[model samples]
Target chain A: MGITDETLKRRLDGFRKRMRDKEIDMALLVEPDNQYYVSGFRAISYSRPIICLVYLNSLQFILPELEKDHASQSARTDELYVYHEIACHRGKDTQFHRPLEHLLDRQPASSTIGVEVDTLPAALYCMLHERNFIVKDMGPDLMEMRMKKDQEEIHWIKQAGVLSDLALESSLHHVQPGISELELDSFGDKKLLEAASQQFPDQLIGFADWTCSGITRSFMPHLASSTRKLEKNDVVVHSRQVWVNHYRAENERTFLIGRPSNEQKYCLELAIEAQAQAMQVVKPGVCAKDIDLAAYHVFEKHGYGEHVQHRTGHGLGLTEHEEPYLRFDNELQLEEGMVYTIEPGIYVPGVGGFRHSDTVIVTNNGFESVTQYPRSLEDMIL
Target chain B: MGITDETLKRRLDGFRKRMRDKEIDMALLVEPDNQYYVSGFRAISYSRPIICLVYLNSLQFILPELEKDHASQSARTDELYVYHEIACHRGKDTQFHRPLEHLLDRQPASSTIGVEVDTLPAALYCMLHERNFIVKDMGPDLMEMRMKKDQEEIHWIKQAGVLSDLALESSLHHVQPGISELELDSFGDKKLLEAASQQFPDQLIGFADWTCSGITRSFMPHLASSTRKLEKNDVVVHSRQVWVNHYRAENERTFLIGRPSNEQKYCLELAIEAQAQAMQVVKPGVCAKDIDLAAYHVFEKHGYGEHVQHRTGHGLGLTEHEEPYLRFDNELQLEEGMVYTIEPGIYVPGVGGFRHSDTVIVTNNGFESVTQYPRSLEDMIL
Candidate 1:
């Protein structure tokens, strides 16, 4: 209910417009991100399969009976078909195919359908193909449409950035010589949730602000969390994610407990310089790879090129990671309202990691840094 | 390394045995749960895709470069393939398909391959079949093999149940007039995490204990949480999920803020009785649907059949919800070591809701309750 129905309607209309131009008659959206983007129906869909079928003039959200209450509560489009109920499908010995067919039968049956081939389950794809419908990949087009953020989406995403900053700040306040990474994580999350609740009383934002501490585990990027306690000269990575009205953003910083060694200070400042260089040129029409290159160039200039491991960053919105990715393989142009995380890290095996991640929004002539946090080497030294 | 390699090896042998019986030469596991079950490689795979290709003779874990470090550190299987490296695929382009082929090429070139058709992306599925490999659904076989819980899995799941109980208990202590639901949620999570940190300091489990409070919002079963204060005579349904080494379990209880009205007390006791009845019959060789019927029968006897919106409950393991769901259509028999949740909920329009969910495992003769939370109305009433 937080996101306006008008906004959701506009999104659906955008997809339908692309469908018509591509000569596609129907579209089936199965990815939870797409479902949430289109209809505001968000549910834990890791193992369970939920289907959202969209026709030229109608839409049906297919889910299990167990999920009905939640689905009905959140979904903007309310035409729901039960996965367990044969009566809902209204066909002989009904299964997924029957319900899908039943929904399609009421439509014009234009034969051409758009499916999320990139994310939809394989069995469902084969079933539809066997039923003889012309199928096309909706991934490219859907991604293209989703890259540019609307004002409503931007508002939610910016709020997520704010919450992430709150968590990062909380992490900084809690970091000490004897503190366990898990302890900081739980306390930081609680602080973020409390801050978010104070801001939006009616909503709850999802969070994953796990700590990656010490040298070895910190070197291994994407470490969820560890039980290792922070010690003097240890690098504590506080990578945080906060979801506001389903829009998510990433904000992180590397803290040096107590003090930094000469190498640690050099790596920390080098990472900040790399992040700044990437942020400086993040304007409309700039190549995504160029931002990544700028970060890599900093490490090379500093003679720490071997320590550089990942791309500068990737995009964020409804999901933590999305389009407009900053990588070497792709040459995609950044556009206004396109948001991405600009995290450039240098992780040395035995010396711990140094990095700071911030959500950045590409504006007309410059970039708007949504995540505002101190990144100087002196400021980050605990 | 959370679960022992010996356990992972046994699990691999189990899957390989199934593959041999089905004559599936190569199995491509893309589901995160399947990957974790086989190789102990756990990652947040809601959006990111990780591939685990199991050959007759060897196993290869394919992941993106960013994920390589953590994947290598935890995965028991040694063979690792980097998706970005052209050397790994040995072709012009290095995409997801090429590395998949690189692994498949090492095998005896069997025409038939097993893939998780139920969960694998549609485009990947079509591409494999188009490449002339007769792709068959491994979902059924994999599920059958996963239905019976191993000792390692059960141990982790039991720990999750314990954390849930701790969290629920913590929530009970904080529930009082003027206390907001979000605050209780944060406090409860902190308590659970603090306890976990002390026991398994190296691990930080994922959590999402959604709350449905008040009258109208509580009527909407999928309500995540609100900042609304827990006033006197309010109904609060706390549905929690705690993860232990990626194995998940649910332990939920509907609580009264101050005291329940006559109607509320009647409904609460009815739901508890329904849950108890379902739990009573959860023994080896018992039909799953009959267990669901036990709960539904109770609701019908109390003339609250229409108020009963959902099935008894679903299974829980790697994910919070999985297979062996207790529903009328399903005729699958319960077996020893198979774990599931037994939750029977009743929701009236204006009167609010009542339900208690417990993680239960089918035992040799009877049933074992992994979740040991108090279900009595007086005990839960603040």
Candidate 2:
């Protein structure tokens, strides 16, 4: 969807201010997510090298001619320049490298060009260097801009959360005796497709244990479902969610297939308490590490500190995993309009682990949990 | 699986000979497919930063430590060197910037290092260049070697093909009206997961023609199902086949949700015939373009030339889309042991498109269609 002209202006203005403060002359946005963030356009043809050169006064988009129409309609074009692909026969198309040359010809030399150096291909970088563009680090600055979610972004994420909740409900039905872990993933995946308001790229599916046991937790974001069948007291942890290009919503809950033992119940309670503790203190101005510490302290008080593995949470948006992670070392302060996860878990080697995770948007005073799936200890049952 | 010690030595010797002939001292393999070809390991971390440096006598596998074990298990120890997470991690054992420095420390100054410059990240390239390693283009030479599959690679591809055929067959029964496209994908995906010999990433599941009238041909190669309700004459096209790492055994066929018109029948017939004609000429000592021409001419003769879009086929193995493509421009010679697709399609913009793609391996004499799913027009009934 095209961003409103005012919104585009606002974003560009924001970036301009940040660039001026950092003394970066021009930011060359290459990463798809960053491009989408500043211009509100996702490239239709990514095969041919394409990028947006965003300057304070001028915005230029370079793309193959086949994709020019899509780019023009999607990107706010009143302030942008377009590159069209020539109608060349298939063989001749390989030698077509004039667009980049044309862009360089029009621009000034010796101007410091900020690039998403981390993602730009070596060939493209070489080509740019050959033309004498002074490439500098623009990745971190661009990341900072996208770290905060605006109202519209949060709205979409909340919508995505609703779909995730429905998908979890549908998938839970398939977890019966004899069902393989892989089958549960497929079942959950199918439910996601059925539940989504609309399909997104990558057919994104994140499947993990509902409860970590033995060597299962090592995989972290394991794509394969568990091989072990659900037993009477088997606890499983899983995250069911999707991201439509960066705007993401996920909900994770640990479940017991049947009856649970006292230890399992205790583990689940600790995890819930840990998550609750993070949630209680989640608000604008709080250091992200404080949330991790809050959750860590709760687990430690219960003599399960070592088992509180991983960060309390991580910022979630455009990508399923992003910056401002709620880890012990992170110094990012929680801000209004910031959305991230509050996932805290406890794992015991031979036994199992419990985790409660939800996407939460830091609000003016507190936080709004986007994931509405049932997380109460009473509701989590076979 | 570790390559047989003999096979590893033989491949290494072959690479050395090729490098010498090309006047290159060393070629760096970073593309996962190329890395898997040289070393028998395929990484589950598809987009993660990992680079494998292969020299005349030794191979250095540099990656995030989480992947060291996977890479080591895939390649031989005699030729392996590893750089782990310690060098890369910056804080909380999470953020990392060290392994990259470690990689640069090992690079020999003034040595000719061949890199797949097209895929290498710009930042990494700059870092390597700053360390004084001269980088050169190695993709063309490596791609030439991979155009033809070896005996063992062909064997695994055929095995993957058989499993894919079964997956398609079992999933056909689940296609019906009122079923969401995601449900169809899930059913087929479940079968694939159950029958998986090895995990393949981004296996094709072209359901509706999402490109044109949103029916068959448009949603191709790597599309997941959506919540779109299946209906009469939807012309569902699913190639939810498994890819065994770089080796793929993909089989795609269109289905008539209900009764299909004569136009639809002709489209499917023309596509199947085109694929047949292309298959007839498949063998060693032929150029890839000839195979493409065979199919192109047939469709042209049938007055459906304009309808046939995209390349006639593409090489398979290592990457789902590989070199030696069956396109008008491809002049690469077909050799025995080369494996690729011979898919020919006919797309009518507003109605639907039809394609019949099969994994074909160039035999010593002719060719063998690895995907043996029934392709008779009569067998395509819903």
Candidate 3:
């Protein structure tokens, strides 16, 4: 149903090996996704601060009292230190830092502590620094470990892809002039939930979507779905990410409403071709930059290179956007089991944005796209 | 419409005044909500580092190239330093830190900087520390400013509350034993989006929901809505947060399905009474703890105090949970225009969880409940 104990053990072992290599006595994980990767427990939000400390031989969780029971049932930890928020347990540990400090006291004064530098809050980092603990960044190590997908992770990602395809299909089916961007997104959301409920009972499923409709809105890369009604000749960039059991698969498409200009149709086809070119470059032993360049050349050859705003794609799994990004500057070699989104987008001020993203896993020789939604210009025009 | 330019100007002035009082020459905000509060712009995600710098005279934004157009349109910043990910802009700023370092280089070497210590990443903190800048926490100041909603904020929140009530009604109308928790949530989600699309044209509307059905699942709060089917005699805690233009209003309810036990009915009534007691204490000049204790007393009087795990309520706004928490240890006085969620619950092991949450804005004398979903036991029993 969730991450298996064996999987957690393997992850811990890999993390421990990296910790040893870095001479880190302990690793403090504050990132929710990183913590979930190691402890197999994730809270809805970290507004109260949930800290997962991974010692060489043991795992510890310092969490809010509300999550005490939930973490106990799910977390693969050796010790749990619950912090109370209510009045009844006022005298006891009421803040996460209290338990964290207590745990830090047990360690030798000179012990080097590892943390996800990019995610750990400055306040907590200062606490360790004040104690004279040698702090080191373990962010890259964790990202490297999580970059490659295991069989179990791939399985959930596949399920998410299937659900995302269903959602995209539903959204497209209901797309019409005068329907608001949010209303268009709602149709897919409803269908996805219904289908997921029927097929994957008892599994935790979540999704996020962004639909930027109209020339002005779609020209910008990121925006939430608003109540802006779709109009004739409007361009809409709809993106959806669905996750099953915490593994994510991103699926996005750019479509045109009635009477789209020839330029708009051409841009949509270019985006589709760019995505295909990027996906075709996905194979074991290929450089990540090669994938980005492959897609860039397509747009460059078409005289739309100056319009490209972002990188080709980003790694996908537990987080919305992880490391091993398919960027021109990233020289990381592609490997089997690594999953990425092959989305190459270009935004022209008057024409609008064009992009189609699909989640694909690098296979033994090439890549297997989990998201099989249609991407042709004919399929996209509504 | 978005935040008014005058409102952003006033917010900046207030923030600058706080900075002056604290002797902070410059303030760096990393938390998206805080950044948005000051700059009137927020990205979808911070996977790419988006730093907002606030000085006494001017505001600056350091963001990715992709967000340049988006920020230019939405942000009230005087300066923007765009960092590129693609190779074409390689000679220019290739990473966020490059621009960040350049910006810092312009600051006085011995200047003190205010930062949201709880939200700023350790990596950025270390960068500042290495350059010998004195860092101070401005998280409390930001929280204090955000705790009290302005008239414009209240307007959006009220709209969110109205939409939430409509969504809740739709979900309850479709509630059935055979429906999965995710399916239940979808009904509300669909209704909310559809209604929002019609009512608030071109405005950004978003929502999140958690449906914990059955005794075991309901007993533990904070779990996401899953593909678990509802059953007869089930206790379901359905929680929702709907936001309009980023101002949120939470509306939640605990309902009984098909013939709940007598104990379950009593617990639901007790929870409703506790919530009422807490709401009654929400007035200007009252301590925050008073609101919590008022609710705590109800459960304590019933000899079910031990069943309470979380605080009675939390401040509601852009973030899921913010400051001025209604906890026994928090003695901060409630002020007019402050918003809080009056959610008091008792999670009985076998009887299930009973809780109802409603967002309320503090008024001159008492409070105005924005979320007016029915809370009567008779209304809850299905």
Candidate 4:
């Protein structure tokens, strides 16, 4: 968690450039990840509204009265405001409307505000509209700014990757025939967590919950753990995840309960090969979607094209999924300092599901696998 | 675990009663807890938008195509709409703007719609307003309805209580002289999770993360677990939480390590007495604020009034903190079936913080404590 004020300053400078291009005088940020990116402060905004107003040269955080102490401890911003101290009717401040208006009044009255419309509540939007402030969506400019990872973010992601590997190794050790998917998941979760206190000791980095889907249940990409016990030839799809101060990394694998059937082997090998082939072309100046095409072409050549379910991969950073999603038609180009998960999956109803994912970072020359956990079929046999 | 259609039916009927009283033709639910309370469906809506539309006699669910199978399994509604097709950009649907408009088109264009305006994003609200629908806030109507806990929900809360006690007991055993706060949190976390698969073999209940805030850190109630190791006179505030399906419950304790100073013992006793006094008045027909006053009176009598930080407690159910926040100015009356935490605290930064919380349901005569984890000063000594 080596987040520094300098890093926050760098991100703020990037936002200012984007704001200048978008002609937004001020930004009303509500998204947790977005706020964390602009300011070093990150607190819960799920139960209540916590906003950050970003001007070209200043950062202001507005939060509930209860969280004032937390903001003071974590927020790098100097200007802070709390609601409920102002006008209230029945001791309830509805929508933080008055507080938001009061903050907006501090700036130029006609400031063109850039709001995260996708996440900000509509009632709050109406309040801003009622005040006659020109509003615009903080879309491409904001998303593009977050697309590239910083050295600090990459460092956290790498640390998370180490934890991910530990979790995966624990899952590999527990994938027995009689064990339930949930039982195996707990083994991995506890295994890594048990090591955390001994290793990091004081660090509060959190282990993301994970699950394994045994048998045909593995065909579903995001299957929850089941009470169903693993059987021989069952394809067990399991994943390990960890977040170091909100920067996350994932290492997913498709393992066999016992000996793999020929069909299962075929699916697993193709997935592995497809991932290898897809990643071979990953580097700066590459189209994000073309990376997906590389994997799809492999599946199609093997006559299991319809079995491809999700995209080749998704960008990974502070949030689990970020911009430059490796979907088929995304025209965004991959850039250096961008980190992504390169996963190619194929699922057949009766046979089984096969997929392997690794976290990789685009480098100056090529791509570096940050989470290089083994994805080989023979190595994954339980 | 025995969630059934009857539970959903009962909740829907209750919503119908409120909708009729409020003259709202239909309701759009977005808050995860609110949607889960009404429909059996519970899926991630973090990165994507998943909406629930409740009409007079029907329930409709709209979600991303990736969650179609999940919606089918968990949602009681038959009118499910998935945005994207199995393919990529060719079938990609942007926001639910079109899907929402289509759903609204089935009703009167000017139909009066009740919305969770506090949580609904501004972008989605604009779509509804743009469609010429009469929009109204579902605040008072919704909060009042959710305030009361159903028997099934109460059952889940009680079950969560059992797990909480287990976690507290484990933490009590692990609070040694030199263990770091995070190390202690992990000890309890692992101990509880280690037994999850065996006890509830079919359940996928996830535990909410908790930590031990040792010594001076305890004064900051929500302080993240640090590297600080336990000392002879440290006061450790630790909480345990479990979510059964979507219902959540918490049990928190302030433990005295090895030995306690006179100040520590005094603060601990005052906090315990304050909570006892607060719960003594928690019955039907009592003002929510009065319960807070009961605690305040004790703290004031003890000359520790300024030490009190947050509200006495908040209503608990699907989410951690809910309606009927026990603040000094809240005028809402307590009613039977309303469940809440009764926690009173004294935080002296230089010394330590002391707080004990219990989840209880208002009964006909008074209240019954659901989370009866031992918070006695003698039992807390490690």
Evaluated on the second chain alone, the candidates' TM-scores are 0.93, 0.86, 0.99, 0.93
Identify the runs in model 3 with alpha carbons over 4 angstroms from their true place.
Answer: none
Task: Write the residue-wise lDDT of candidate 3 on A175-255 in tens digits.
Answer: 899999999999999999999999998999999998999999999888988999999889999998899998999999999
Q: How far off is residue A116 in model 2, in Å?
A: 1.5
lDDT of 2 at A83: 36
Fnat of candidates, each listed: 0.50, 0.25, 0.86, 0.33
- What is the full ranking by lDDT, best candidate first? 3, 1, 4, 2
* lDDT at residue A156 of model 3 (Cα atoms): 98
Q: Residue A169 of candidate 1: its Cα lDDT?
A: 80
Candidate 1 chain B worst ten-residue window by lDDT? B85-94
Q: What are the clash counts of all predictions, listed in order?
A: 1, 23, 0, 1
Chain A TM-score for each of the predictions: 0.93, 0.84, 0.99, 0.93
Can you give the lDDT of residue B148 in candidate 3? 94
User: What is candidate 4's lDDT per residue for B1-382, written digit by digit as tens?
Assistant: 5468897888789889888887889999998778877887777554567899999988998887556666777788859876742243355564456788777778786888999887888887887787898888886676777899888888877777777778777877877877776567766666666565556666656676555566646777665555456777678888677766566777888888766888888899999999999989988999998998899889888888867766788898887888778877888989988988888887886778888888888988899987877777887777
For this target, which candidate reaches the highest DockQ against the unseen true structure?
Answer: 3
DockQ order of candidates, top first: 3, 1, 4, 2
In model 1, the number of clashes is: 1
Clash count, predicted structure 3: 0
Once superposed on the true structure, which residue ranges of model 1 sit more than 4 Å away at CA? A45-48, A66-74, A85-97, A104-110, B45-48, B85-94, B104-110
Against the true structure, what is each candidate's TM-score? 0.95, 0.81, 0.99, 0.93
Report residue B238 deviation for candidate 3 (angstroms): 0.2
